[model samples]
Target: MSNTFSSPLAGRSTGDRLILGLAILLSLVMLLPVLWVIAMSLKDNAALMANPNSVFFPPYELTNYLNIFATSSVFRWIANSLIVSVSMTVGVLVLSSLAGYGFARLNFPGRDVLFVIVLFGLAVPEQAVVVARHQIFSLLKWHNTYQGLILPGLSSAFGVFLMTQFFRAIPKELDEAALLDNASRFRIFWKVLLPLTLPAQATLGIFTFLNAWNDYFWPLISATRKEMYTLTVGMASTQTNFAQSEGLGYLMAQAVFAGAPILIVYLFFQKYIVTAVSGAAQR
Candidate 1:
C-alpha cells in the first residue's frame, strides 16, 4: 500500500488547532450578516417580504440600487461629503502638525499647561458643547454652509495628541543635523520630521476622514436644506414611512452605497493602517 501523507495541520498541537478553528468560526459569524445584507439588497422587495428565505435563491436584480440613483439627490450628497471630509482632513493635518511640532520641539512659557488644556479637550464630550457651538455658528450665519461643517471638526484634540507623541518619539539628532545646514524651523519640520511621521499621519488622516464622512449629528443640525445634506443625512432622509417592510431592499442598497466609498478608502489604506497599528503596539 502507498504511504499516506499527513495534512498540513498535522504537526500543530490540539490546542492550536482548536484556536484556529475558533478564529475561523468567529470570522464566519461576523461575515454572515454582511453577506445577508448584500443578498437582501439584491433581492426584490416583494420577494424579501413574502419569503425572507428568498435571499438564498437566484434571480438577483439591481433594480433597488438603480432606483436610488434615479430618484435621490445622492450624488449631490456624496459631493458634499467629499468636500467636507477632504477639507477637514487637510485642515486637521496642518494645524495638528504645527501644534505638535511646537509641543514636541520648542520651549515656551506655559507650554506644558497649554498642552494640558488641549488634553482636557479630549475628555470633554462633544455633546456637552453642541448647544454652544450651534449658537455660535448661528451668530456667524455659518449654518447650512460647508465652512460650518468643516471648521468645527478641524479642532481635533486627538489628532494633535497623536502627532505630538509621534514627533516626540523621533530623535532630536535629526533636528540638530538640519539646523547645522541652516534650515529654518518650518523647513526642518516640512522636509525632515513630517515625512518620518507618515504612519501616524496616515492613521490620523484616515480616522479624521472617516469621522467627517460619517458625521450625522453635526450635519443633521447644520445642513437643514436638502442640497446641503451629507451622504449620511441624505440617506436617512430617503427612508419612507414603510421603509422597513416595503422598501427593505432599497434601504439595504442605500447602506451599501453610502458605505462603499469608506470601504474603498480602507481597502487602499489598509496596509498603512496595519503598519500604524503594529508600530503602536511595539511602542
Candidate 2:
C-alpha cells in the first residue's frame, strides 16, 4: 500500500514539473524579441558590424540613442501621432456611442436598413478605397493636414457595432424609469445610460486609440510633408535610412521610441480595458 501511493505521488510531481517547464519555455519565446531589441539598441554600429551574433549583449557605446534624438524628427512625429490618435479616439467614442444608442432604443423608418449599410463598412478594406479617398481629400483641399488624417477615421462602423451590442444589454427598466421621471431621451442617455456603460466606452476608446495611433499605410500615403508625419511614418523613414547604413542600434532605438507611448497608455488603462472587453462580451 505504501509503495503504490508513493509511485502515484511521484508521477504527479513529474507531471507538474513538466508543465512548469513548458510555461517557462513559452514565456522566454515571447520575451526573446523584446530582449533582442533592447540589446540591439544599446550596441554601437562598430560592435554590431564586428560581431553580428553579439546582438544578445549590450553595446560598448550609447551613441545610437543620442544620434537618433539629435538627427531625427522623432519628437515632432510623436506629437503628430498624439494629436491624431487622441482626436480620433474622442470623436469615435462620442459619435459611435450616440449612434449606437439611437439604433438600440429609438424607432425610426429605415433605421434597420441604415444599420445594415453601416455594418457593410466593416467588411470594406480601408486600403481598397484609399485612392478614391485621396481624390476626395484633394478635391476638398485637405491633403497633408491633421484634419485630413483624422477626419476619415472619425466614425468607425466597428465602434457603432460594439456600442450597439453593449447598449442592447442595458435594462429597459432604466429607460422607462427615466421616462416616468420626465427625462428627455438625450438626458437619459447622457445621465443614466452613459454612466452605466463606462466599460464599453473604455473598450471602444482603447481600440480606437490604438488603431489611430499605429496606423502607418494611410498616414504615409496621405501626409506628404515631414511636419505631418506620424510616429509610425517617421519610424518607417528611419528604418529605410538605417537599413542603408546598416545601423541596427539606431533602428532599435527608433522602434523603442515608437512603441513606448502606446505601452504607457495601455498600462495606465489596462484595468479598464480588461473590464470593458469582458463586459462588452457579455452584451
Candidate 3:
C-alpha cells in the first residue's frame, strides 16, 4: 500500500497550523478598525448619533459617498492631487535615477562629500525645513501655485539613496559590456541599467506618489487658496461646523473617499510592491 498526501497543508506540523491560525486571527484583528470605519460610513448620521452600535445592525446606505460626490469642488480637489502626486513621482524618479547613476558609476571631485550631504537630508525633519522653504517660496511668489506644491517634494533624499543602492547592486559587467558596444554613459543608463532597476523604481515611485498625495501640512500652508487645495486639504476644508457630532457618517465617508484611490492603487500594484520588498530584503 502506498500513501501520499494530496493536500499540501496536510504535511504541516501542529505548531505550523497553530502559527497559521494565529496569523489569520491577527489579520482579522487588524482589519477590525477598517471594518468599523466602513460600517460607520454606511449608517445614517442621525441613526449613528442615536445608536453608535447600529453600524453592526441593518439599514446601511450609500448616502455618505454620494454626498461626497455631490460637493462641487471634490472633483477639482481630486484633479489637483493627481497632478501634484504624478508630477512629484516623475520628477523624483528622473532626478533620482540620474543622481543615482552619477553616485554609483561616475567619479567626480567631492562626490563622497556631496553624497554625504544628501544623506544628511534624510536626518533633517521636514518641519525643520518648512519655515525656510516657505520663506523662500514666499519670496519667489510661488505660493498657491503647482510649482510650489510639486517642486519642494522633488528633492527626495530617500529616493536617491534607494536608486543609488539599486544601481550599485547591479553587476558592473553589464556597464562594461554596454561600453564595449560603443554605448555612451547616457545611452547605457537609458537603455541598459535603467531597465534593470524597474523593481526599485516601482518601489520609489509608489512611495513618492503616496507621500505626495497624502501630504496635508505642506499644502495647507503653501496652498492657502481654495482653488489650489490638494485632496487632503480640500477635504478638510469641506467639513461643516461640529462635524464629529453632527456629521459622523459624512466624516467617516470622507476618510474612506480620501483613502479609496490609494487603496485601489495598492490593489493594482501589490504584486510589484511585494516583489520590490522581497528583492530589497534579499539584497
Candidate 4:
C-alpha cells in the first residue's frame, strides 16, 4: 500500500512542478505591462526619453504626482469616482437581490416572459440607450448631479442574472423551512437567503464598482461642470494632460492612480470574487 502511493506521488510530482512553473511564467507575462507602467511612472521624463527602453531601473520621480495634483483636482476626481462606484455597487446589490429573489423563487403572471425580456436586456448595449437616458435625465434636470451619475446604473441585467442564478442554487427547502416558521417571503429572503448570496453580491459589487469607476464616456457627456467630473472623465479632459508637456511618464502615473482603488477593492474581495466567478461558471 505504501509503495503504491509513493510510486504515484514520485511520478506526478515532476508534472506538478512543471505545471506550477508554467503558471508562474504565465502570471509574469500577464503582469509585465503593469509592472512596466509602474516603473515608467516612477521614472523621470528626461531619463525615460533618453533611455526609451529602460524602465527596470528608475531614477525615481515624484514630479508627475506632485505636478498633476498642483495643476488638477485629481483627489476630487478620485472622490467622485468613489462616490459613484459605491452608490452603484450598493444600489445594484439591493435591487438585484430583491428582483432576483422574485424572479427565482416567487410565482407571478408573466414572470417567465418578463425574465426572458430581462435576459434580452443583457444584449442591449449601453451606447444604444445613452441618447434616451440622456434625454430623460436632461428633462428631469439631473444632468450634473450625483443622481445623474448613479441612478442610471442602479440595476443591471448582469447583476440580476447573477443573483438569480445564485439564488436558484440554494435549495428551496430553506424557504420551505422558513415558511413553516410563519416567516414572510421577505423575511425568508432577507434573513435566510440574502446571507447565502454574499458571493454573488461581492461579484456584482466589484464589477459594478469597476464599471462605474472606469466610466469615461457617460460622465464626459453628462458632467459639463469640472466640479462634477469623475476620475476617468477628469483624467481625459484636454486640460489635464501629458498631451504636450507632461509626457508618457506622467500619463502612466495617472493610470496608476486611477487603477489603485479598484486594485485595492479587488484584493480585499478576491476570495469572494473567485468563489462567485467559479460558482457562476459551474452553473
Candidate 5:
C-alpha cells in the first residue's frame, strides 16, 4: 500500500514539474527577440557581421548608443513624438469624454442615430481614408505642421465608446443626488463622475498616447520634411542610413531609442490599464 501510494505521488509530482518547465520554456521563447535586440544594440558592426552568433554574449561596446545620439536627430524626433502624443492625449480625453457623456446622459433629438453613425467610424480602416485626409490637409494648408499631425487623432471613436460605457456604469442615483444639491450637469461630471472613472480615463489616455506616439505611416506620409519627423519616421530614416552603411548596431540602437519611451509609459500606466481592462471584461 505504501509503494502504491508513493508511485502515484511521484507521478503527480513529475507531471507538475513538466508543466512548470514548459511554462518557463514558453516565457523564454517570448523574451528572445527583446534579448536579441539588446544584444545587437551593444555589438559593433564588425563584430556583428563577423560573428553574429557571438553577439549575444556581451563584451559590449557603447559606441553604438554614443554614435546614434551624436550623429542623428533622435532628440528632435523624440520631442516631436512627445508633443504630438501629449496633445493628442489631452484632446481625446476632453473631447471624447464630453461627447461620451452627452451621448450617455444628455437627451437630444436624433442622438441615438447620430451615435450609431459615429460607431461606424470605428469600423472604417484609417488607411482607407489616408488619401482623402491628405487632400483635406493640403487644401487647408496644414501639411508638415504639428497641427496637421495632432488634429487628425484628437477625436477617437473608440475613446468615445469606452468612456460612454464607463459613464453608463455609474448609478443614475448619483446624478440625481448631485442635481438635488443644485449642481449643474457639468459640475456633476467634473466633481463626481470623473473622480469615480479615473481608472477608465487612465486607460483611455495611455491608449491614445501610445497610438499617437507609435503612429508611423500617417506621420510619414503627412510630414514630408525631416524637421517634422516623429520618432517612428526618424527611426525609418535611421534604418535607411544604416542599411546603406551596413551598420547593424546603429540600426538596433535607433530601434531601442524609439521603443524606450513607450516602454516607460506602459510601465507607469500598466496597473490602471489592467484594472480598466479587467473591469470592462467582467461587464
Candidate 6:
C-alpha cells in the first residue's frame, strides 16, 4: 500500500518542469508590450523621447492618467464603446441562438441552402461588403447612429455556426421530453437548451464584444459625429491632439485604458471560453 501510494506523491517530471518554464517564458514575452505600455504611460514626454527602449528607469509620472481625462473625452469614449459592444453582443447572441436552433431543428424547405449561404458568408471579408453596407446604411440614414454601429455587426457567421453546432450537440431526448410536457419550442429553447449553452454563449459574447470594441474602420467611415465615436476611433484621433513630444506617452496611456475592458472580460470568462472553443471544434 505504501509503495503504491508513493508514486502519487512524486514530484513532476523534468518534461513537466520544462513545459512550465516555457509557458512562463512565453507569458513574460507576451507581457512585455503591456508592461512597456504601462511604463510609457507613467513617463514624461522628454524622458519618453530620450530613451524609448530604456524602459522602467523612472521617477514615474503617474499624472499621465489624470492628464488624459483632463485633456480628452476618455469617459465618453468608454461609454460609447460599452453601448456598442454590449448592444452588439446581446443582439448577436439572441439572433444567432434563435437562427442556429432553427437551422438545426426546423423543417423549412430551403433551410440547408440558407445555412449554406450563411456559411459562405464566413468566406467573405468585411472589406468586400463595406461599400454595399455603406450605401445601404446611407440610404437608411443610419450613419452616425447607434443603429449604424450595432446593426451591421448583428448577423455574424461565426456566431450562427457556434450556436448551431452547440445546439446540435445537445441530446435530442431533451427536446422530445420537453415536447411531451406540452412546452412550446421557445420555452424549451429558453429554459432547457439555453442553460446548457451558457459556456458557448459566454464564448460567443466575448468574441463579438471584442470584435465590436476593437472595430475602427467602419466607425471611422460611419461615425461622422464626434459623439458617435467608439473608443477605437476616438483613441486613434487622439494622436493629433498631442504634440510629437508627448505623443508616445499620451498614446500609451490611452492604449492601456482602451485595452482594460477586454482584459477584464477575458480574465472573467477564460475557463468558459476555453471549454466553448474545444467543444465547438469537437462538434
Write down the lDDT of every candidate, Cα atoms only.
0.92, 0.85, 0.93, 0.86, 0.87, 0.87
**Candidates 4 and 6, the one with greater lDDT:** 6
Spell out the clash pairs found in candidate 3: none
Among residues 3 or more apart in sequence or in different chains, the pairs in candidate 2 whose N, CA or C atoms overlap within 3 Å are: 43-59
What is candidate 5's lDDT per residue for 156-179, written digit by digit as tens? 999898898899998989999999
> What digit string (tens of lDDT, one per residue) describes model 4 on residues 88-148?
8899999999999999999999999999988998999889999999999999999989999
Instruction: Give lDDT: candidate 4, residue 64.
Output: 72
- State the lDDT at 51 in candidate 4: 79
lDDT of 1 by residue, 77-190 (tens): 999999999999999999999999999999999999999999999999889999999999999999999999899999999999999998998999999999999999999999
By the TM-score metric, which is better: model 3 or model 4?
3
Query: Residue 230 lDDT in model 5?
Result: 92
> How many clashing residue pairs, candidate 2?
1
- lDDT tens digits, residue span 211-232, model 3: 9999998999999988899999
**Over 4 Å off in model 5, which ranges?**
1-25, 241-245
Alpha carbon lDDT at 67, candidate 6: 69
Instruction: Report the C-alpha displacement of residue 77, candidate 6, in angstroms.
Output: 1.8
In model 3, which runs have C-alpha deviations exceeding 4 angstroms? 1-8
User: Is candidate 2 or 6 superior in lDDT?
Assistant: 6
lDDT at 85, model 1: 98
The estimated TM-scores of all candidates read 0.92, 0.88, 0.95, 0.92, 0.89, 0.91
Which lDDT tens digits does candidate 2 get at residues 100-189?
999998999999999999999999999889999999999998988999999999869999998888888899899999999999999999
How many clashes in each structure? 0, 1, 0, 0, 0, 0
The weakest ten consecutive residues by lDDT in model 4 span 1-10
Model 6 lDDT tens row, 136-199: 9999999999999999899899999989988988999999999999999999999999899999
| Worst 10-residue lDDT window, candidate 5 | 1-10
